[model samples]
Target: MAWIMLLVAGLFEVVWAYSMKQSAGFTRLLPTLVTIVGMVISFVLLSAAMRSIPLGTAYTIWTGIGAVGAFLVGVAVLGEQVNTMRVIAAVLIVSGLVLMKLSAE
Candidate 1:
């Protein structure tokens, strides 16, 4: 399904983001390769999802999911700051994504 593909793409977006950080400006060989592979897979899935879903809607959802997921990962796994503003902003992003999905129906 298009939604499933979008979700997978979003998940890969997070993976690639984290892998890119680990790549250390591409100085690390394994992580850099992983990042490149993840990025390609992510974009491919995104394109596949777009075949069935409206471009605007799919892109917004994909980016929203990826951004929120990555932010949570950074906070929970990387011990990044989970400040009040950041939390509120993330909540807003998720709310907007949900609203978009609902409205698209």
Candidate 2:
């Protein structure tokens, strides 16, 4: 349950990040509202997940998911560049996330 909440929170983190970008520095109303709502939900779920998951592990995983997810979204949806170095960096982040999860066990 906690992991599920954490995953959802991480996803929300991505949503907020993308929405923030779409918000045009908060000038846009709808995207800004979506960003605000997404951030609140993400933080709430992260707080709940923290009750069970270790702080370092949860934070690392949360940020990792957000980072990689945002990268993918930027590439796929926003037509951002996808270079070898960036791909490798994302892979390293995912590897670290796996290591962090393993260490938590």
Number of the top candidate by TM-score? Answer: 2
Models 1 onward score TM values of: 0.96, 0.99
Model 1 misplaced stretches (Cα beyond 4 Å): none
Taken over the whole model, the C-alpha lDDT of each candidate is 0.92, 0.97
Best by lDDT: 2
Error of 1 at 12 (Å): 0.2
Q: Model 2 Cα RMSD, Å?
A: 0.4
Residue pairs in candidate 1 whose N, alpha carbon or C atoms collide under 3 angstroms = none
lDDT of 1: 0.92
Q: Which regions of candidate 2 deviate over 4 angstroms?
A: none
- Residue 42 error for model 1, in Å? 0.7
lDDT of 1 by residue, 33-56 (tens): 989998999999999999988888
